[model samples]
Target: MQIDVLIDVKTTLGEGPLWDVQEQRLYWIDSVDGRVFRATADGSEIRAWQVPQKIGSMALRKNGGAIVALARGVHFLDLNTGDVELINDPEPNLKNNRLNDGKVDASGRFLFGSMDTLEDGPNGALYRLDADLTVHKLQDGIVVSNGPCWSPDGKTFYFSDTWSGEIWAYDYDVEMGSISNRRVFAVLQGENFRSSDGSTVDEEGGLWNAQVYEGKLVRYAPDGTIDRAIPMPVKNVTSVMFGGENLDTLFVTSMARPPLSRFPTDSVQGGSVFKITGLGVRGLPEHRFAG
Candidate 1:
């Protein structure tokens, strides 16, 4: 299916596009710009929040607020009052590390990853935040950590180490919040495919991965097979989410990062949100901040 550019925000580093069903709005972040943006379904009424530092990802909380991964900590944000409270900060000893890409799991727990600010540092880690605001370190030694999506049945986990260009599957125990039996799910080929960034799971347990440099989103079956490819007009497709009233619109976020110097001039669709209609299965609802 052909993707159409819906909004051109021209963000310096756009990522984490999430749909809020309750408010009927879309939320996303511009990491380099330190801005959080919200817009209507049709890209109208654009609103922004000026964060103190880079924001990696955000999700609606179960308790009626939002949780944002900002700088080196996780914060609780009040959507109605615009108040941001620091909730948790792991790896406080690693001054150069900060949170990266993340999402809330089906069980209403926030699963996020962090990376070393100074490139090549082996300090990145993945974390799971429970409903009670307790954070648990799941894995370590990651570089440029990315997706942490759950399968449809909530029995498997799909995660990626962007710098390594590999996606892995894990046996997820939701009740205990643990992952085991790690195995390679897919190994991306070619130098053009920079890395796998943010991702989401469809109803059939297929993983939809956003290829940051390749300018495409790929759907991979649970058995490590390529199901289909959705090409993007921009070269830096950061992340994707399924939205719309019927959950049929696929909302995509793009970036204007390095190795794509043509951004401001040659890149026409860079830093824009595109939508693909009538292609994807309904997505699970986002978890709200209960604390």
Candidate 2:
């Protein structure tokens, strides 16, 4: 499959890639730039919203609008009226931390995580936002919390602490809103320094995860074995989500960090969002936040 640059804009840290199946538009956030973007399927008619703070992620609400995450807290963003309602702040004490990757589950609950401000140390944690608007901290002792995704069956949950270079799977109880039997599902083996950034599952239960600094996308089977690898044009591949009309198109987002002395020349393609075509597998539709 050929990875095409759907959006040419450079971002300091472009992470989330959300597909609006209803409007056939692609949405994503630039973490460091404090911006969210919306664009047509063909990359035209793009619009941007300047968030007040660095946004980790966002989820579409069932009623319209979105559930937004930032360092301060999760807020119900009413785009229609330009209003932001505070859902809850999970980390009021951890001022050095900021919210990171997040997504709503199949049952309409939001799963989100936080990252340490310095980008190091085990100061991050993961939280789940229930349909009733209750916030629950699921796990602690994390660094750069990301890739909060669930299996197609909702029986397993996958997450990662980017600083650790390991993606973990949890035996999930979707109905109970709990996870257990945590274990490694995928590991990046190398001395060059790279870790799992973001992920999405295919219809066939394959986990497609981006290996940051490695410049590749790794697809792991349900058995936790390497299924395939696709090389990217940049060194900082951030996240990927399956979108498009048939859910067969894969939209990948990336980042271009400040002068990393080693990979100095790849900054051009690092921050652009890409679209991959010809993938035989389709993806599950995104779940909307119930609240």
Output the number of the lDDT-best candidate: 2
lDDT of 1 by residue, 1-291 (tens): 557878898887888988888888888999877888999889999988887788889888766868899986999877777778898998788888889888877678888999876646668999988888899999999977897788888889899888787899999997887889999998876455558888988777778899887878888988988898877787788898887676667889987664235323328678888888868477765556445
Q: Candidate 2, 90: how far from true, in Å? A: 1.0
State the lDDT of candidate 2 residue by residue for 1-291, as single tens digits: 778999988888888899888888889988888888888878899988777788899999898988889878998877666577788999999898999999988889999999897877899899999988999989999988988898899999999998787889999998978889999888776448667888999999999998888888989999999998998888788899999889999999988763234543466787899999998999888889998
Clashes of each: 7, 0
In angstroms, how far off is 286's CA in candidate 1?
2.6
* Cα RMSD for candidates in order: 2.2, 1.7
Structure candidate 1, residue pairs in collision:
60-288, 61-288, 61-289, 62-288, 62-289, 63-289, 63-290
Name the runs in model 1 displaced over 4 angstroms.
259-266
Model 2, which residues run further than 4 Å from truth? 258-265
| 10 residues in a row with least lDDT, candidate 2 | 258-267
Instruction: Give the per-residue Cα lDDT of candidate 2 at 279.
Output: 81
